[model samples]
Target: MSDSAVSTSRALFERASVVTPGGVNSPVRAFNAVGGTPRFIRSAQGAWLTDADGHDYVDLICSWGPMLLGHAHPEVTAAVQAAVGRGTSYGTPTEPEVLLAEEIVGRTPVEQVRFVSSGTEATMSAIRLARGFTGRDVVVKFAGCYHGHVDSLLASAGSGLATFAVPGTPGVPASSTALTLVLPYNDRAAVEQVFAEHGDRIACLITEAAAGNMGVVPPDPGFNGFLAETCRTHGALFVTDEVMTGFRASSRGYWGIDGAQEGWVPDLMTFGKVMGGGFPAAAFGGRAEVMGHLSPQGPVYQAGTLSGNPIATTAGLTTLRLATDEVYDHIGGVAETLKTAAAEALTRAGVPHVVQSAGTMFSVFFTDPAHGPVRNFEDASRTDSTAYAAYFHAMLDAGVYLPPSAYEAWFVSAAHDDRAVQTVLDALPAASQAAAAAQGGAR
Candidate 1:
């Protein structure tokens, strides 16, 4: 809790910078947004993380949404341990790969699936498949919806969106992103206008299904329906990038919640995060006609030595199998409790905030009470992020860990029970007070 104690993490960060970019493998982990030394996690179990100094905190970031069953869960650990005994990587097909693929196809009712190493790989391959299948170059993506760091997909995206501060990353050529049209999230008319102009040349229109990157902004009512219908009418493929929302949002991911409820299906869906149970596993799949274009079947080629690594598949399979109806219900209940507690505290503190959610994923946005609603990136950007940074540090000091940036969503896992929820609730008043103080009582 003191500066001297926290300095150990600073020391590690200084050491890390000698070899790694920005002293961290991931930019956000550097704690640039919150303006503090990043805690070096020694280990995690259930819903708590033990820092280098042995300080424990309730983890709401959940490793950026992969530890849905919680870090080092027994069943998942057992599965991974059992897998390690056999081998780590086979480079050849294994039973777990088939089983995992079957499990995914069974849950989502999509056609065949292709396993990949990361969410970025999944989205990248999905885009290639879309272009190959449609013979078009343009891909439409929503502003503030991150589809991984794949060059074209990174344009004007969120999550690491504002952090990198480039209109697009430097490595990607201007011409490559020329076909990557970015639109405002939850704005149907904007999407329609873009498609109206370039629909014929657009291969696909990809989205987050539920916009989680920009602080869990849900699609405006009928927005996704409009996207699906518009894509259909324009002869463009509708691709749902559920890398973060997959499994964690619900058993079948955000598209399941959004699509099943709205009676529409995307041409392709990319999955990762909870599906891999914290391993480097990911997948992309959809209509047979579209997927058939990838390797051994068609001209479009994509392959990875670890594409279907047995260890990752085993962990993923076990995690998915355990995400039963009861688990989902329990997680949902926990989310509700945390949401209510935070909202109640903010309200009582006279702080203006909005808690957006889809299943177990949520984020608290600091805004003027007059803002009322945030349906898109434009609305989400209007939030007082400096106030959020203040609240974030206060929560951290109180042993509640939230994502350092306002753009990232807070995740709840099945392991988060009454105690974890209560910890967050108890910490909220002080955090809200800190936010209000930082904003000069503007709330």
Candidate 2:
């Protein structure tokens, strides 16, 4: 199939629109923010995606963060296959889950973990545990720091919802979101003020250890430390939602990077994405006492029939084992290469831009120093998104796939090597030109 042969995807999408909401299982897949038909992906390997139209593009979105080792890695595929032969869903305890949990704890050394089905489930359960342990009702989150679509956490979501400009999903009751206190990212004083007012009623203050949902916004110096101390002083649990940054950010993830340096650790941390190796597995863990508040051990209740599904566990274990020190170094190198290339391209085009990054995750914002640095969601909202959309389509047309929205981070996997880097670089000139042309259209 070629892009011209629209029979398969177009026909499928047309039929799907009537049955599924917006013709996509996920809203971002509709490409509404990017203003074009989405290339339906059929298969992926290494750093490339083959679309249903038979077009091949070097993938930078990396399946929204899980493909840190790239799609269909041999070791992961083999492990999943072996587990499948044993059985898909045991609905019982499995050794792989234990091994995966051991690997996570061994790496982070912060707490005991419980595996769940998705990042949403992990955050949902973690919030419930925090509430149960603290005997409180309020949860604090930052604007533009998405922790998945759990009803309470979507007050100021950043990813797909931000991309599409959907105010809030229609189904969630307004009262359900009333308890969520949304604040600006990287504002310590604001956080302190909120804690001063509502700390007693607040069960937890959750944030992306590094905010990837809003284009790789790293913590300001001493920011994570302030959060840790504030939470402790106020008797609120500090929960780091590392679903996108978990293993992909570093061997131990963003918390290990910032928390260790600051001599602080969150009371609870959630993990997903790269840890699952593209499978639907996630976990939340922290101090044993805090985690103990969850289920059979305490009053908070969370259970899933597929909580530790064998196949997902096997995939997770294989990916975690493969992400050795060398793998991290390789991913870091690739990220640097991409960042340098993008910066050079933007500079040469005389485009005012800011490249925000952490480990292998990065995003390019079409704004200058006059914006006073994108410290929070309000600053991030000032980016030239229409320019980004044009750049995205140009890159896609030139055989490189970036995240469709300006708000989302572009991920670099260990599998993206010299060839992938060169491919993106080759596409940059045209993408830059397109971005410059579209700059005035940004709102």
Candidate 3:
């Protein structure tokens, strides 16, 4: 994109910053990590995003995994439009929510689900239910496994093994995270140690079905199953936060690839993203036995005025109903091709890198292959961000928009046709070259 093309976005961002912190509703959208004028998107269609300057780029972020069928999917738009005509929200229970809930139950291990407006609400509510059911005060989570900004979940690892976490952000008080335990992702020994030390006091252990926020880190084989078993032994709920992977990793989310075949089920699971189609809808659910402890069924006390908004549920329901096996298969195929092309391009440009994936969701780390796969946040942190920044801008200039930050999954959609795939394939080599140059002769 030309400087002339970026001028409009720059102007819009300036106007946005006057009213919004960091000039964006979401911090990552500010482009602080990549160092550029973040594009102000005016519209999107299929796999392409048109910025205020009218430059169209292949959208690899896929709205952070919600646009599984891609932007402006005809069926989803039409359904949402029809639902809107009936009324946007009733502030009461609705049929669309029930149908969507039933769809989730049929596709995943969750026997019951409660809808919420955002992934943050979904995880926060799940944590509360777990504590209510188990009657415990402590919560455990892995580092780099973002379960939204729930105060307790937003925490940094403490100085010692099994120690209580410190607040990850300023607004979160020490007391909020006082009962939270933070451990390294994929560290089975650390998990064992934490549980052994405070298993009796723990309410639940929550994790991403696969880590995506810290750039795709798949759990070790049998890792999730092990967590489930460990949680069961300790009488703590095992909650997988599938906010980014639900219905995107496969038809049933990552569990379909791992848990169903392994024959172990989580005690609770949180879902968002693709399940919402392109709307702000999320849900948390599990076995009816445990879910019975929530709300009117029992006395956990959770409520939302617009929890089951008809429009959001209709978009979500329509999207899921259209998300057939073919959708996943097509997306997976495209992802594989792009992964190979990127690796080859970077290799040819003499850039050392590693591409890590959890099923179809993946990220290319500008780290050394010598370090092996990025299994944890520490390893993911080793990725060369400066190089990634150069690569990100190069790809953006070349008409393929990747995630602005290095530590994020590059989501793809079924709408990514050969044209879109070719755009990404065509951009890799040059972007790799830019990255190599940024690393001082690919040093």
Candidate 4:
């Protein structure tokens, strides 16, 4: 059917369903939680997405935090184009990879790094390296803190898993999660208890530096530092997953918010999103001592055919080079404005809600105000997802593209100028009212 007969997004989705599972490669992209036709984006520029139907929406999701400098950023595009002319992949070491690694080491605490194709690979490799380095089998992760789809890490993940109400997936067997200890986020007592019970057997404990996957639930004051201290005491590696927050939350990512100031650093860190500048690139690195455990230096086996693709590294390197203090300041300012406007809009509509932030990244939870400041998965689960569904579609109709899932972070970019910000601000009040109306199925 043509777009005239049916909405282009719906038609395309129907066609895609014949070939791809759920008509999307990624589950959350299907809009399963928030019911609607997922807009098929044709192109993006600055902070706007032009859909297949020719409607342009202010892009608040920012490709889930990769477009820190915004879609098709001129400098980053030029860098990728230039690198492409040289060639795409070499399957061999490249100067861009070295430069990117140096840039990462310079900005963060990681001393050495290894490139991968996705955040999942970066994290999976980090965990394996942790196991090899510690000679232990157990891994600990926090509830509502997503590290990716690695078998062990997926036990109680957030993001798509949280949105779809899947406690854990099927393909992952019981044995896979046997050694995984899932703890509540921001609960130091829980961490201490877990370490007390399994300290010797624990290889590593990984967490989102600040939990963005569960809607920007930040670590409590001194919580990350405490995790680091406890891990150090127990001889377990502290693995901070910055895949979502790296470079997007701040110049040095979420770690810059507290870890740097408190003089605490994770033994390992995973990075992606903004570092790739929208390309398929990611990395994990840490103290040279721990990283050295990976072969051909050590015994832990981790390899990727496209580990350091030239063009991807060039795009990432250029993006990082351009992500200056001013870029972060601009994004931070945009986040503050939008967060305040969203909270006010929700209040005006008498809709229960809470806005939470971890540096420049944030999310609005459609939950009872009394139950909020969501700290863990249980608290996060209390959000009224149906109300968010209404709010999301209302904003979509009003020329604002938000994260389709309520559990995901809403990203802003340095390119979110006055026009884009105003577009979002204009949409919030009506969306909030839609959420209010949806409370009792009135909408």
Give TM per candidate.
Answer: 0.95, 0.95, 0.98, 0.96
Single out the weakest 10-residue window by summed lDDT for candidate 3.
434-443
TM-score of 2: 0.95
Clashing pairs in 3: none
Evaluate residue 58 in candidate 2 and report its C-alpha lDDT on the 0 to 100 scale.
Answer: 97
* After superposition, candidate 4 runs with Cα above 4 Å error: 1-6, 157-167, 440-443
> What are the runs in model 3 whose C-alpha is more than 4 Å off?
440-443
Candidate 4 residues 284-357, lDDT tens each? 99999998989899988999999989988998999999999999999999999999999999999999888999
Report the lDDT of model 4 for residue 434: 92
Clashes of each: 0, 0, 0, 0
Better of 2 and 4 by lDDT: 4
lDDT: worst 10-residue window of model 2: 158-167
lDDT of 2 at 159: 45
lDDT of each: 0.86, 0.85, 0.92, 0.89
What's the CA RMSD for each of the models? 3.2, 3.5, 1.4, 3.5
Model 3: per-residue lDDT, tens digit, 8-66?
A: 99999999999999889888999998898999999999999999988999999999999
Name the runs in model 1 displaced over 4 angstroms.
157-167, 440-443
RMSD of 1: 3.2
Error of 2 at 124 (Å): 0.7
Query: Residue 435 lDDT in model 3?
Result: 95
